[model samples]
Target: MVGSLVNSSLVGCDFSSSPTSRKPIVLAHGARRGDVVALSSIEALPTLAAFGEWLRKPGPWVGGFDFPFGLPRELVEHLGWPLEWQACMAHYAGLSRDEIREIFRAFCDGRPAGGKFAHRAFDRRAGSSPSMKWVNPPVAWMLHAAVPLLLAAGVDLPGLRPGDPARVALEAYPGLLARELIGRRSYKSDDRARQTPDRLIARKDLLARLETGQTRLALRLKLTHPQRDALVDDASGDRIDAVLCLVQAAWAEREGPPGWGLPPDLDPLEGWIVSA
Candidate 1:
């Protein structure tokens, strides 16, 4: 554990490349004290500009961002993008969304039906959507919108890039942790009509497990009554997903930096998710 990071600010962001008021980028801000991570507040950034501004805030903080920091190395190689991390990101950021979709679509067109998308080494372990996937989740666009801001903000991404060590950034996927607590249980839905009682019950059960520190992280979630209720009531699950990321951030902080509990041999072109 890094002594300097004890009780330091921690953030977990559930991001959207194209954010709007209805489905804004949600941030769960908290800190770890001993084995408990206390929820301080939840914030929503309704635009990419707001999210960019938030990234530039002074740090000595660690953030677990729910976005892909890098694309699959296989995809990068196939498209002949820069092999180096920084250069690859620079080239990727230079292209428009349309261009990205066109190129990715062509790439998929060349592959077989079932294995159309190239995956990063950690994708299977984390159970996350492929970073190259531009639809459904649109994580590819999320990567496009986010990595440039992180680069501009000078945050350190362990095992990938080096910058401001105080402002540590790690790729996070809430599904990894959520699956540990509730296997294949759907706890949320964006559509109001689909927010069924069973889903709400699942959310409550998930929260119960988290509060009891039942997951492998073994860190209890400290939430006020209202905070607890808000997580359960948010049918979209964005808020709870952010909190799930917050817990991952806390675990990474406890493990300290450089690897941050990720495998030391992680691909520089496809960063591993923390705690995956």
Candidate 2:
């Protein structure tokens, strides 16, 4: 696979809408080393464009981005959004934040609370994480809006797309991983300034798993002195997302994906990453 250079470790990403957002890029960098990579990181980025530009630039990487690749086929069909990825991106991009929320709300209103919206099968495995949820994370819209941009601009998504699959993209659900470890604790963060001590504690426990490589989905991270402190300091999960992405990069480096880890029934236009 073109993304073979990515590394055995998989980094988890917590994405933002644009550059202006204070949301720091979280990454879970992993490699064979002293290994504190599982802990949350607080990395900096000037802008969303700068971040996107980095994805195409190149390095050993494979990102398990915490976003959706495409909306539910059933949901899109019901809402009557454009059926194709390209057209869907245009349609999603065209909507204002308010308008998008309204449409999502209307869609939610029709369904039961727990059954409010449909989800991908992978999401079922991912559990009740909102980031994985089609409606909550709007990852489907993410796939709709972001993937084309990524493909056109030249990011890698091995076993999924041709050309340089350096920045192999996957719909990672940290919440899926987190829920198993921490359960219903408040892990997601909205404000950089408001990150609480509880988050730091949770990060500490999370780091234990990465250090010992306790879980089946463990990351191998090599953190610099600065990197370690930076990760330790982050109370919110943004910087941690970047660290997660680094771990994902390492995982891709280790694993070989023939089809970006997707099922045969998966949509080609939708794309997916291979899972172990």
| Best model number under TM-score | 1
Q: What lDDT is reached at residue 247 by model 2?
A: 53
Model 1 clash tally, residue pairs: 0
lDDT of 2: 0.56
C-alpha root-mean-square deviation, candidate 2: 4.4
Write the residue-wise lDDT of candidate 2 on 187-242 in tens digits.
54667665778877777666545445555556544456676566667666666556
Question: How does candidate 1 fare on TM-score?
Answer: 0.97
Which one is best on lDDT?
1
Report model 2's TM-score to 2 decimal places. 0.74
The clash tally of candidate 2 reads 54
lDDT of 1 by residue, 89-208 (tens): 999999999999999999999999999999999899889999999998899999999999999888888888998878899999999999999998999999999999999999999999
User: Candidate 1 — which pairs collide?
Assistant: none
